[model samples]
Target: MSTHETSAREEVDAIIAGAGGWRAEALATIRAVIISADPEIVEEIKWRKPSKPEGVATWTCRGNVCMADVLKKAVRLTFPRGARLDDPTGLFNARLDGSTVRAIDVFEGAQVDEGALRRLVLEAVAENRAG
Candidate 1:
């Protein structure tokens, strides 16, 4: 990995480590699946603030593929170009009405279909590239 990538990874690691409990576990698991789906994917943290110390985790290729934020009730994974992607598995359960974005909100105790999520990520990447 490049130096910039390493720095970003370290920053994201600190964010994940600090988000203890289920949030931490969920972020780690979701991150692993995203990386597995695209080996060259770039990870970064955005929108940092005192209220939200961890900011949000964003993965991109050419442009944003998806971002995940740990909320009180669920982990929201949003795809900026999701409206254009074909979601056959119906994994997206949030932001359905948006004209450009769509999201999948994973609540606590909910089992994530990693296969479907990965497919969505791949499709999102394709959408990004096509733009």
Candidate 2:
């Protein structure tokens, strides 16, 4: 799929629909992180990801992948294979009790480590290839 083929709203409707208002905001966060890092991947909101590719794309394997969910106070960033990434930044330890796929919660005015999250996503993509 290409940008001329569809619009962002149409793409958002694909996965962000029925996700509620906060869902769009959560999607925005996930997107901001992904683009801020690797701004060159052929990103699209197919199923699991609304602003990026799911499973395999320009990189990675057919793994569980990452996702975000809206919460009462914040959005939870869940990486299904986070344990595989050797994160230099401690952006994923809060929601995770030392697990593979970890969650990073972000809320209003909360200082989110965008670079770190982006690194985590890229790392997950790289890990997919490693295995």
Candidate 3:
């Protein structure tokens, strides 16, 4: 892996570890699912600042696929091109009103539809590659 990619992966690992409890587990699970969806997907740490220096956990193929943030009440997976992707299983539950993005909010004890999420990731990668 490239140096930046390695650093980003390490940053994500730190974020997940720092999250602790169910949030950590959820973020790890989400990361695994996203990676499994496409081997070309790249992990990134974006939007770093003093308030939240760890930044957001972002995944990209040819373009931005999604970003994960550990919220107080939920772990959010926001798809940048979600508006163009089909959601037959209706996995998206937040940011529905956005014109170009959609998000899935995973709260404590909530179950993620892995199959649907994998499909979405694949679709998002394809979308990125197409452009």
Candidate 4:
């Protein structure tokens, strides 16, 4: 892998490690789901700051597909172009009021629909490639 890709993955790993407990596990699972959805998806770390130096874990396919954040009680997966995508599975539980972005907040002990998530990732990638 390239140095940049290696660094990005490392950063994401550190973020997941820092999260600890179920949040960490959820983030790891989310990462796998995103990657498994598309082979060409690239991992990235963005929006670094003093409080969140590790940044956010982002996946891209031709363009930005989705991003994951470890919240206090949940792991949030946000799609930038979610409004345009068809979410028949109703996986999105947050940001429904927004016109652009949509998010899914996975709380502790909550069951995640891997199949639905994978389809969402595929749709996001397709959206990115279409533009």
Give the per-residue lDDT of model 4 (tens digit) for 1-131: 89999999998999899999999999999999998898899999999899888888999999899999989889999999999989998999999999999999999998889999999999999999989
The RMSD of every model to the true structure, in order and in angstroms, is 1.4, 5.9, 0.7, 0.7
What TM-scores do the predictions have? 0.91, 0.62, 0.97, 0.97
Candidate 2 segments exceeding 4 Å error: 2-26, 35-61
Measured with C-alpha atoms, the lDDT of residue 9 in candidate 2 is: 32
Residue lDDT tens for model 1, 32-100: 899889876899878889988767789999888999887888888899888998888898999999999
Candidate lDDT (C-alpha), each? 0.86, 0.58, 0.95, 0.93
Model 1, TM vs. native: 0.91
Model 2, range 9-68, lDDT digits (tens) per residue? Answer: 355444445445665556576766664554343343334455435321121234534655
Error of 1 at 63 (Å): 0.2
Which model scores highest in lDDT?
Answer: 3
Measured on C-alpha atoms, candidate 3 has an lDDT of 0.95
In model 1, what are the clashing residue pairs, if there are any? none
Model 3 segments more than 4 A misplaced: none
lDDT of 3 by residue, 1-131 (tens): 99999999999999999999999999999999999998899999999999998999999988899999999999999999999999999999999999999999999998888999999999999999999
Model 2 residue 66 CA deviation in Å: 1.1
lDDT for 32 (candidate 4): 91
Could you arrange the candidates by lDDT from highest to lowest? 3, 4, 1, 2
